[model samples]
Target chain A: MSRKLNFYAGPSVLPVEVLEELQANIVDYQGNGFSLIEASHRGKVYDKVHNEAIALIKELMGISDDYSVIFLGGGATLQFSMVPMNFLVDGKVGDYTLTGTWAKKAYTDAEKIGKVHAVFDGKDKNYTTLPEASSVKPSANSAYLHLTSNETIGGLEWKHWPETGDVPLIADMSSDILSRPVPVDKFAMIYAGAQKNLGPAGATIAIIRNDLLERCGDHLTAYLNYKTHTKSNALYNTPPVFSIWGIKLVLEWIKKTGGAEAMAKRAEKKSALLYGTMAESNGFYRCPVDEKYRSTMNVVFRLPNEELEAKFLKESEEAGMLGLKGHRSVGGCRASIYNSLPEDAVSTLAQFMKEFQRKNG
Target chain B: MSRKLNFYAGPSVLPVEVLEELQANIVDYQGNGFSLIEASHRGKVYDKVHNEAIALIKELMGISDDYSVIFLGGGATLQFSMVPMNFLVDGKVGDYTLTGTWAKKAYTDAEKIGKVHAVFDGKDKNYTTLPEASSVKPSANSAYLHLTSNETIGGLEWKHWPETGDVPLIADMSSDILSRPVPVDKFAMIYAGAQKNLGPAGATIAIIRNDLLERCGDHLTAYLNYKTHTKSNALYNTPPVFSIWGIKLVLEWIKKTGGAEAMAKRAEKKSALLYGTMAESNGFYRCPVDEKYRSTMNVVFRLPNEELEAKFLKESEEAGMLGLKGHRSVGGCRASIYNSLPEDAVSTLAQFMKEFQRKNG
Candidate 1:
């Protein structure tokens, strides 16, 4: 069966090569007589898979020795609570920028845990805009400045990172991680759920600076604490084995296909196709995001009316495209073209969008 | 290559049928044009998989509407903290049974959260024996009584449950879930990591009685809160999609092969074969676990000496048996015959055990 152009916002697209490799090894991993899923995490078989996944992430992003790379479960949403629970101690506040849906969620969850101040809230602008990276300032007693590098739902992304000297900077890069070369040294930590650019939906990858590990409080529970993971190298408990295994394959695919630099170029080319189509369409396809903050990962757009959008979705799926429907909260369209989404899928979608607009118009 | 007898503790053996289905669907799920791993959790494809997994658990376990079975990540280790955080309120003590390593870990984590009482401490017995169910009692002000239904490392299991009339009973059944019929109404909650009898390592299944969820505080962060999962049907955040998907398939297999009743008979037959082999070995093979409380899932034993035990593991691996070596914490041998482990594997191991003792004795 031919594969569909998967544009759904995460558990999004993965390279066909990775999926095929996963199929090949699903039952017998390297003729070990058992699937890696069944192997003990402590055993040599899984140890290689686990370490290679971490090493690949570090190599791809150029992470330094000062940083520790770890894989976890519970997705990036758990990180929302864990970040503040570990870092946002008494007498220090967590500074957050509510640029879009994901940023607001991180801020909301942080507020429940401890003292959190929103440095910039885009709610008033209907989450279509982002605060200029240099314009936002953290509080005096800020423990960490938190931001969502890309918002999947709102289609706004941080093209430039915030400058917080002496204050730790943390970003939930769940949607856009490894899509491009990241300045790993600039942030204290960056975490992404593996469903998007990494692998499948079970594992979450976090890169933490060694200094930030000291901030993890003793009061935190074992799994909730970052220190526990760092100590055990994320083998604190039985990891999401299959998920991490998938990530390793996907990472290998990325590395073989020219690493993060090539991913960035592909992301640019893919997003440009859609955005460029909108530009040439004479206002038929409208992107709600600010031009500068438009996400290269999730390109969310809308038609002239709700009826046309519904028609577009119906026609797209009939044309063998899936997940073009926008988030239910904000109705329109979304094409999440992550790292593993082929350039051809984007080209096909671009062609589909043009044909849909022509027939509907 | 023929499959070996897999016995590595958690992340242990899964049904060959389930693995085959996983391999077949790894690239394109049921000709859906995209792998389920790459499908959105909120989409119909994954929503069906998630709901079916929950429904199957409810059906197999005879769970009533009074309970909510939700899937979460971070394994059962996270549940160790979550149980006390949600249920162990102020002015109430969480009653615990330190039956083995897992129980102790749960108790230790709970201690950091709130006041906890060890109703039955098995440390004096070196975690080889379990307290009689009727003999154990919860404190008057106890909010809930927690027990480890099966200890994977120590090869100890609870044959009967502690009766706490008014207080809720919670059990970490990570290693022994679905191996036999369980009285769902007796316990307020039961959670298991899905690497053992269920499926794989990424997902943790929690069966919580409805009343317990109400104890979840509003101050708790979204992912940490039980109410957040129950309200959204475990869709509050992105779930471990592939793990849960694997679980649904396993559950279906369990159902088709005559449900919990058949699993119980198979487990009894398999475990008896190993224990009988030890009993007939005349001190050559010794099981430290008290016979009355011997675990059906993890059958751990020791040979005459450390040298023989090492030789046994080496020969077993060479003879196409894997994971026969015990956990690093305990230097012996363990054959984890989980629900998916074939009866023939146990028979072969029993024959090998007799031959090894005859030669070495």
Candidate 2:
């Protein structure tokens, strides 16, 4: 199979090994006589897969028993609402940091739910910068301090996490989850849409400190309550079975390939290659985001002009590369080199960037 | 490959053809260089898939422009809350019929959301029977009348839909959707989890009459509001990409096999085979569900005693059968013959039932 270099932002590339394994077992999972997709979620076949996925995430991320790692449906966008619905209760205000697009969305959704405060609004800087982790503070009555670890659209990532003493620190890590060694003890909760660094699109992974689940009030509907998922081990409903199975396989791939530390190193190396190439270009390419807040996952940059950007995208597609066009909101180019995207693909792109500049610059 | 006859309930059997197609394209979709799962949800590759899935559902269900067919995540359990959160506004009460475990769960969730009333409760009959569709009536101020089209646990199904003239009629057809044709105009909304007749888990298909969107309030969170999905055509968030693609394949298979009418005939034939076997067994086997309400999708029967039931389950597995054990709530044998389950599998199960009785008796 002639597989192109995929650079899509959120539903980005996955390890070839994971895809091969999924392709091999899509029909009959380990000779259990039926595809895992068609097997009952409560049955032993899928139950094992479900638990293994949770276990691997815990082991890979070094999470403790004090936290519950639950998988839910509806991407990180759902978490934008559920995070506030479950926590912004009992007269507690939600403290949010508007670092970029996704964090702003979480804040906006929370405003519709209850009282919320934005501790740091990056909108003044057009979301091209971030607040100092040590400088940001939550309000006294804040239930939780929320932030997005990385903005896929704005191509900004937090280099360090904020310290929120008593108020729980919650993060939407959809774009950069599993791409680094995170200090799990520092945060009360972390959520991610699996399409980015985990596996596929159907599942959302949430790691909630056990204490936070107690705050999930009875007023919330069953599915909306985090307690329901934690109580049933995310089996309160028929889970995204096929998606979870795919996740289990991807997690296994992660473990076999030297775990989270290896992934972090790969991320640094891949992002540096693209950035280094841009640094060499003489005013031909420019990255809009502040260099300190530059994302390791999604590297957004611009060519000399809109015409060159259009030509670059078309040529990239013809040259066996895809998903190079930036989001419409940000009119430029983006290469999302998530955990599964090989460094070689970035090198290929970097080489292409130089060649394109030579011809046009 | 030693594939066995599978009889799982939800997340149950799927057509071999669908499985093969998925297996073939799990890595490189249509030679697009990357798997569809890896492609961006907003891009052309997945957009075509997303829209085609919606279009096919509209065509197969004979739905018109008046209805907005949308796919969402979090299953029917999420819908339980969303239905009330969106519709049970402005002092309108939701009328629910308590039929079985699933129906009761829906009712209980709505209770937390707003004022609700049980229009026709089958609890008096221990959920072994259903209310006659014509006999059931909604309260005057009812915003909508809700019913479970088929109960996967109790093995009961509504033979005819309730006629609620002014009040919107809604049905959760998670277990038996697409198994037969229905009058599309009768219900204001119909939602089903894709695990059963539609495809795999992760995607929930909702066909809502356009007017229902008007009732979705601004008070609700973005993901919680049905209007958000309708306005963006279910692309409000990064959708469950792989699951929707599978649903599209399953829909195509359904169309090729002969639409819903053909499926109805097959359901009757397959269900009759199992029921006929029980009838021939005389005092050896019993079906607890009322004959009129017996589910064609899930054929549940009890052996003469618990010991025989255990023996039947063990021997069924040894004879290359799987998922024959009933749900834990009710201890018996249940063979879920969903649309994708071949007639040959049912014929074999019937043959096994007869031979088991001959040997055990």
Candidate 3:
């Protein structure tokens, strides 16, 4: 299989070149006579890696001095627990928008640690659209507002940042980070799991407000302590070393691929191509998400039945296109065009979908 | 830089062959288009990876139904807190032998949850020998006895597993897990951070006696709950996917190289070669530890003065002998000859030491 197009939501696609770089260095790194993983995280070499990873996130997002970038473990799900644990001080609450599964997960876990106010949930509307900004009632005393910028499961996204006044906005940008140009200063904190747009599944990138870190609770364990990690800059413990290395290569890949602007343009073109194909797919293929809120990173659509979806997935797999099955929340197909999925792969997928519709419809 | 040896303790050297296999699959795995890291942990592909990783540990260890294996996040240090969290009940205490830094860490953290009996320490002797087993005073109702079988620091190791009567032995075999053969049924538990013998740093391998898991607290989080992982066979949460993948490859390498017996024989040969060279240098190069307890993995030695030690380290680095600096507790040169270090790397280091001694001594 020359280029097996992987459209899996996350633990998604990463560039073949990055892995080759890893392959070259897995036994020895940069003439160091040691695997990168074996090098000390506390040493100068790893210090550069950590600093560069943070710098790259900021560079890509074009963030300011006010925000501190943190690379972390536990993926985005851990952030679900961490956000409440850290930010929700005594008597404070967090306003969460339930856009889809990820938002719901973040909100539900938040309720266990602190008070949670559900601003708006598209759950009632079968999660087909994003919650309107007019309905979000940000409490004056709320610690912060948390939302998912792109809901991969529901194929919804916030086209515009919400107005939260003094209440800082936090966004889980796991699915769409770096896929387009995102305003760095709009959110108090933003986290994206690496599998989607960055590199692999073991690391998560966190862009956080420096001052907000002061409010993090001291009661948690050292490993779970955001304050401890924030204090030491994510070196409080032995980090996932190899995964961070992969992310470093991936960040370089992003820079070479023309930064965020070029990526955004390519992503828009790719999503437009796939969605256009789905639109012309007639009664055979249907997209459940509202057009305005559809995610540029993940294009979700459905066939008439599971059997047809199964056939589509199977035939697509045989035709060298895999991970085309949609998430369980939406029963169809989701072609996740993350940063690593070149525009050609997306076009190939679109071509395959078009041909499939031509034969089956 | 060709075939440079890795000496970064935990994320240290992996078998060179695993790197070759990893290169072939980085962008496309087994004809699957997407890179291995891009695959979902929830998907069947990763499930195969997870199974094979655990299966390899069992196969390599030659364990039976008495022991169950699981991979966890946060490395071995997390297990320092987690072992107590899961196994510490209202009335029970645990015994720990402070052989080196890791065991002391394990013992110190276990005290937070319950009672601890520190069996022995070589602090008085400046960690020159393994703490004598005769010094161990096992508690009548101790949950288990914990020991760092191979201490990467201080160059100490339990030459053999200690018998603690009715009390079960729990070993942190992080630096020595596939380096030697062991009777898996003898221990109540054995946990190793993958960076050393297994694969990468993200995953921790825990081999627990099935009956011991029943003692784990019921209220533990699903993520940290041993019972939760043991029941599902370590699929409790989205585990460290890439680490597990690498572990599978490492295990296959170990198998292809004739399993742990071959590994143990190779370790002895490499370590003996290095240690023999140290002995031949007499007072010029001094090994600080008792010869009987000297580790087969970490060979620690000192020069006549701090200047010579510094020069030795610097010149060694220039000569491609990396990670030779000793742990802070015992300041000197440390040559960590883990399973992945080919016999020639050790021979090269030994040759370098002799040449340096002839010129500098």
lDDT of 3 by residue, B1-361 (tens): 5655555565677776787677667667786656678787767877888888778788888989888888877778778877887887768778888877888888877876678877776678866777566656568888788999998887787777777777778899988888989877778899988888888777888999888888876555445568877898876445667888889998998999999999989989998998889878877988888988989998888899999999988998888766888876567888888988888888889899999999998
lDDT top scorer: 1
For model 2, name the residue pairs that clash.
none
Once model 3 is optimally superposed onto the true structure by TM-score, how far is the C-alpha of residue A311 displaced, in angstroms? Answer: 1.9
Interface RMSD of each: 0.7, 0.9, 2.5
lDDT of 2 by residue, B117-221 (tens): 998788778889998889999998999999999999899999998789989999999999989998989999999999999998999999999988899988888
What ranges in model 1 sit over 4 Å off?
none
Span of ten consecutive residues with least summed lDDT in model 1 chain B: B1-10
Where in model 3 is the C-alpha error above 4 Å? A23-47, A89-91, A111-117, A138-143, A165-168, A280-283, A328-330, B42-46, B91-94, B107-123, B134-144, B162-169, B215-219, B231-239, B328-330
> Which ranking of candidates, highest DockQ first?
1, 2, 3
Per-residue lDDT of candidate 3, residues A1-361 (tens digit)? 5777778887877787887788777656776655566677767777787788878878878999888777777677767867887888878888999888889888877877778898887867888898666567688789899989999888887888888877888999998888788887768899987778887777777888888888875555556556767778887667788778888889899998898998988888998897788788776788888999888988988898888889999998898776788876567888888888877888888888888878887
For model 2, the DockQ equals: 0.86
lDDT of 3 at A44: 72
Scored by DockQ, the top model is 1
- Residue A7 lDDT, candidate 2, scale 0-100: 92
